[model samples]
Target: MLLYTESKEARRDVVRKEHDIIMLIGDSLHDFAAEFKNKESTEYQRGLVAKEAAHFGNDWIVMPNASYGSWSKSELKMWNEKAEK
Candidate 1:
């Protein structure tokens, strides 16, 4: 909800002040929208990011944090591993 609200406010800023969105900076997918929120696999998230590949660096700035993020919670079904006793 906060993300959506902030997105809307950002858009409103552009419309009301005639400003240009040079770039968007964030450390997590939630910074963009619920669609990119914690879920599915990293590949799926990468696919979503690919949709805006051209805008990367040019208009979108994704900050990285090794400490933690949604990428950590995202499930990876292709790891190919199991519990062994």
Candidate 2:
């Protein structure tokens, strides 16, 4: 059996061992594949998503994320900043 490091795709080694077609379902892009795990920049990652628009909902399904998401890297502030301290 081939190890994940030995495989080209970022899929798990166990998944790689299978011969059947695989469909990925996840809340994050990286959960689907490493190509979506680009470390360059968020813009670049979005660009990649645009490039693979056709594959979305067809090949891999992205589930909804209920909690705080990974897309927002900005410094967070209190939702309600009070006035007249």
Candidate 3:
């Protein structure tokens, strides 16, 4: 189904319908589904991802989000050229 709306419930209803499997191609976590929306914290979101780790890259195709939201306040590690051995 081609859903083009801002309502989360509408999207959820589409998902509830019995039919072919739906795949979500999203840049941000919120675009995936209703369950992953309005999360408490980044850590909590990460936990939810971990909980449904198997579906990633298969059912849900994740793309890098350019516009920061939850990760804006995160501390990122510096990239290293060589192995830290």
Candidate 4:
């Protein structure tokens, strides 16, 4: 397994280049199309990344860390509950 870290801004650059699998970690995918919701970029780079990943015939997994990555709010709630107990 390999891990690659990239910012949302940077992903716009090479998303359509070429790759076997494009696993977008965190809650970014939830808003993948949000960026171009009102924009004129019909390419839908985010979707393209996902599509390309699938077309490449490789397995892609978007595993976000519950404790730190995208579930910080829920994790905090759980922590507070534990403390209250």
Task: Return the TM-score for each candidate structure.
Answer: 0.53, 0.61, 0.67, 0.25
- Inter-residue clash pairs, candidate 2: none
The digit string of per-residue lDDT tens for model 2 on 1-85 reads 3455643364464555766645767787876667776675766877888888887899789887867667567454554667424
Rank by lDDT, highest first: 3, 2, 1, 4
**Candidate that would win on lDDT:** 3
lDDT (10s digit) by residue, model 1, range 6-77: 554455465557656566677876555456755777788789888867867776677888898666776655
Question: How would you encode candidate 4's per-residue C-alpha lDDT over 2-76 as one tens digit per residue?
Answer: 235664445544655565335434333433433433433334544665564652323334545555532343223
TM-score of decoy 4: 0.25
The deviation in Å at residue 84 for candidate 4 is 22
lDDT at residue 83 of model 4 (Cα atoms): 78
In terms of TM-score, the best-performing candidate is 3
Residue 49, candidate 3: Cα error in Å is: 0.7
Candidate structures ordered by TM-score, highest first: 3, 2, 1, 4
Candidate lDDT values, in order: 0.65, 0.68, 0.73, 0.43
